[model samples]
Target: MAGSELTNIKSPRVKAARRLAKRAFRDRDRSFLAEGPQAVREALALEGVVAELFTTAEAELRHADILFAATHAGVPVFRVSGEVMSELAQTVTPQGLLAVCRFLHVPLEQAVTAGSRLVAVLAHVRDPGNAGTVLRSADAAGADSVVFTDASVDPYNGKCVRASAGSLFHLPVTVGTPAAQAVARLKESGLRVLAADGAGERTLDDVDLSGPTAWIFGNEAWGLPPELLRLADEVVKVPIYGRAESLNLATAAAVCLYASARSQRAGSESGPAPRLP
Candidate 1:
């Protein structure tokens, strides 16, 4: 532990960390709270990302290795009471461990480069959980970057960060860029921009996914608008064979990104597989 247990909920340090629960305060400080052991571990893996760590005595003992790592890295660790932990945490159930981490988003140009093969763009997506799930899916699908457009939810939102399950620190993320500008940059980098919408001329199975691709997913309630759809090289949808109404934003994004990943890997070893009619 770096200092004595922080028992005072109204202490200056405790209050500053608690303020990160709000988006405005997070933006002002360029910092956000990463709750739970998993989120804390992930944030610590990256240099300088974790500024401070808060843990209860039980959590420190339960997750001794994590505390050791934080101390080894010179990250200040504060032992707080369970009550103080609750005050600093955003979740209904505090994990007894939390980390104050700096924002990790990079510039749009840096995120999508010439050699980039796979990318996910969230346009006008509002739900933090949905956006985080999409980001985690993109990371699993070997995407080079995930872009949260200007109108999309902040990637650093606590719920979104938790939903990402530590994948947020695994890949480059571009935030606050306009959807059109992001699409243009991806195209300029030679990526085929595909907009995923329920109503589209082509289905996922019909598109050629072997090449470098960028998938643009829209808001959960209403999908991509006409102007956003027009920006894509192709507008595609996930075909529903069963009687389900439709896939949610996160599910749809995973399907699209994985399809491209599979195709690209296959193309490298053998060749692009025949598209189903």
Candidate 2:
């Protein structure tokens, strides 16, 4: 078609972005779906590559600027109906906008320590939502990085990505089961591995969390893996007097990571803090 004819050509509905939302297709195509205005915006803002953009009519809701950016970036944008958007969307509620993006390969060694040299590890967490929520909190709590270890749920899952809001784009993330030797390596390198336990006698308030610490949270059902716990230098549990059973994995992670951040901020204000030999 000529340029003039192409201008008049119909925009598409239900394009490649919709198809890539499926798990199999995401793997086969090496692309994942990012939904909502914020998710799409972050994917666009990433210094990495965005494969394509699919904005349903309902999802786009006639947002012209978004269309302009998508076109300018050379990302293909298609229009899908409300029904089609729901069909392709992973969420129960379709936010009306979605994008297909290539996953950035995050390295474990490089992303380990951030502010206060504090880190959070998700050991053997299986739920995608919980994993994502933890990542979001880690980023919000000023953590330098997060490591999802063992058989944790795929952090790339749509729900997880969505749960993070836009934090996933900005934070450094590492996923893998590093050898036990590697865990020991981090300990020797100066990470105070503080595992959160329900039975831990030490209160979070008792421990000086201002040093380079790696706050490890265990599985939702079982808590931390024994090997990791055994390697930890300290263990602290949330003090709960209410009749509640236990904190959710993500909730526990937020509490621990923020506590570390809180302690460090206090220490910095008071002057140099002492470290354990």
How many steric overlaps are in each model, in order?
0, 7
Specify the poorest-scoring 10-residue window by lDDT in model 2.
1-10
Every candidate's lDDT: 0.92, 0.72
lDDT of 2: 0.72
> Evaluated with TM-score, which candidate comes out highest?
1
lDDT of 1 by residue, 124-158 (tens): 99999999999999999999999999999999999
Where is the poorest 10-residue window by lDDT in model 1?
268-277
Clashing pairs in 2: 13-79, 56-80, 59-96, 114-144, 218-223, 218-224, 219-223
Candidate 2 residue runs with Cα over 4 Å from true position: 1-25, 113-116, 179-182, 268-277
Model number with the top lDDT: 1
Question: How many angstroms is residue 239 displaced in model 2 relative to the true structure, after the best TM-score fit?
Answer: 2.0
Backbone clashes in model 1, listed as residue pairs: none
